[model samples]
Target chain A: MRLSKKGAAKPDPKEGADRTKDVLGGTEIRIAYKMGYVLNFYREPSFRKIEMELGITRPEIVTLIFLNFREGVTASEICEFSGHLKANISRGIIALEKKKLLRRDVDKNDNRRQRLYLTPAGRALYAKYIPALRERERAMLSCLSASERKLFEGLLDKLAEHVPHWTALDEL
Target chain B: MRLSKKGAAKPDPKEGADRTKDVLGGTEIRIAYKMGYVLNFYREPSFRKIEMELGITRPEIVTLIFLNFREGVTASEICEFSGHLKANISRGIIALEKKKLLRRDVDKNDNRRQRLYLTPAGRALYAKYIPALRERERAMLSCLSASERKLFEGLLDKLAEHVPHWTALDEL
Candidate 1:
């Protein structure tokens, strides 16, 4: 595991002093790090109540959210849309089906594929759980004024739409 | 599995039209969804090469990044800083130790606690892999102008610092 340190500089005292402060502040990775930090707040705590009350995992909640938005989508589509692993989504779909919250139908146009839809139970579960998500989001964004929120949303839209341009590591 | 349709309104044609569009554009969950969308690009592809070259998982790379920033920290500290699970951070620490890239020292003040530091090999590995991360971040943020980037950063800082207020499920 050792690599040649031929060109590696000695750790400077000044740099060490700077490193002792925060995680990513004033660092090259701050942007991504900060974004991830905020996302973490959304990931675990935001969904904790739903996960406990409904006996569903984060992946299952994600599946419900996606199906709530668009019915008759395949697992791969959910994976693509949610950025979740195919295996996780597959497992969630199976669990939701077993829980009687979701159902699958053979795609009429593609016999090899199955499309997912929420059962009435699933829809009701989503309805019951969505307000919490909305409230959490509202609280998270409460720090911003209405105009600042609009500006932030626009910036986010720009970055989200730009994902394809920079997502490939090989391209970098 | 069927839910009572007592108060459930009929699915409107306009709402279905909106649903057929892109994921999370005009929805209540758009902020979180957009942030996650941008984050997925960073989470998977940004670290793909490093993962391949170093034979380290995402959690392990995250471990290295955190250690690089501040050494002599515990796994729990890393979890708090990185928003990763303790089990994953513990696993990464074990793997890094096995690879001889990291070492732990028992705290003199508290023998039950251990502090982690990067080995020379680990430092070299971090040095080599960090440029790619910097470049990826640069590319990701290149879309924004300098002023807009500043604004976005401020918003992120506000949200990240506000995490404590909204992070608890019970608070919501």
Candidate 2:
């Protein structure tokens, strides 16, 4: 019989120390930490696989998503928009450009700044990936109901209201 | 004037693109990811702080917590209990012993296995850190209501259940 590619059999939790099993709500800490842990796993394969398959990480997807809504966006604007550090955005822009997905042009009005626009290829790639990415996103969001997702998004906006440096994302 | 030492600035979302800001829904992903991110940021500092203060890391704390409940834990057992990989637990034991926080005794009945126990210092340190940690945990948890935290933790656990492998925490 063939085992699923996901992994081999699950390790029995019973064999470990019994006393530690329920210690200090051990179960909850494990649960709370799971989403972050799973994100790492999901990202590694999905980003690499999808990026190789389509050539973009989710962050890059965010970049394109925002850029589509507003063209002539600056690197600083992207840093602020994506909440990604400048170095990461800089590197991402470099990667996207290397793939000929986009291009950067010096702002005619501001020499100190550069404006970003998607190349024709970028537009095509974005069109290709968004649907697939949205599918995956929908699947992940399926864990939450529509009303729950909206309320959760609202609460997230509240908690997230605290991050001000994102305004200076250009300095990122 | 000097900026705050920790730079715990809250992010402002209105200024940036709203695309990725609430993409994951709820502050759950942002808060937790930020916690993990902050933990990673202070990882070196946190590790050194614990070493100088209590001789432990976040992962080691989990180990000590588990060991406190049950002494004489084997490497494989610790790995299983902590959801860490074998390599991580191995390294963790080596580090704990180096700090004199824990000791591994060769199982008399089983030559191939060893049992781990925390030193007196480990217990003392745990007692000291627990209160401070509990406070920070409460602050984070306060972002959600009692019921939301319950549902959130459940979602996180379900997420972790899907991940195949994590860091080699067991060996560490």
Worst 10 residues of 1 chain B by lDDT: B1-10
For this target, which candidate reaches the highest TM-score against the unseen true structure? Answer: 1
Q: iRMS for all predictions?
A: 10.1, 8.0
Q: At residue B103, what lDDT does model 1 achieve?
A: 99
Q: How would you encode candidate 1's per-residue C-alpha lDDT over B34-146 as one tens digit per residue?
A: 88878876766667778888789888898888788678878766775577777888899999999999999988877866889999999888898899888888888988999
- Stretches off by above 4 angstroms in model 1 are A1-21, A168-172, B1-21, B168-172
Query: For residues A37-146, could you state the per-residue lDDT of candidate 2 as single tens digits?
Result: 44444334344556678757666765676566567778765554345666777788888888888889998877877788998888887777656544544444555667
Q: Mark the regions of model 2 whose C-alpha exceeds 4 Å error after superposition.
A: A1-24, A27-34, A37-41, A48-85, A106-113, A120-158, A161-172, B1-93, B105-116, B121-137, B154-172
Show the colliding residue pairs in model 1: none
Residue B48 error for model 2, in Å?
Answer: 10
Give model 2's TM-score for chain A to 2 decimal places.
0.66
Candidate 2 reaches a DockQ of: 0.17
Task: Give residue A47's lDDT in candidate 2 (0 to 100).
Answer: 47
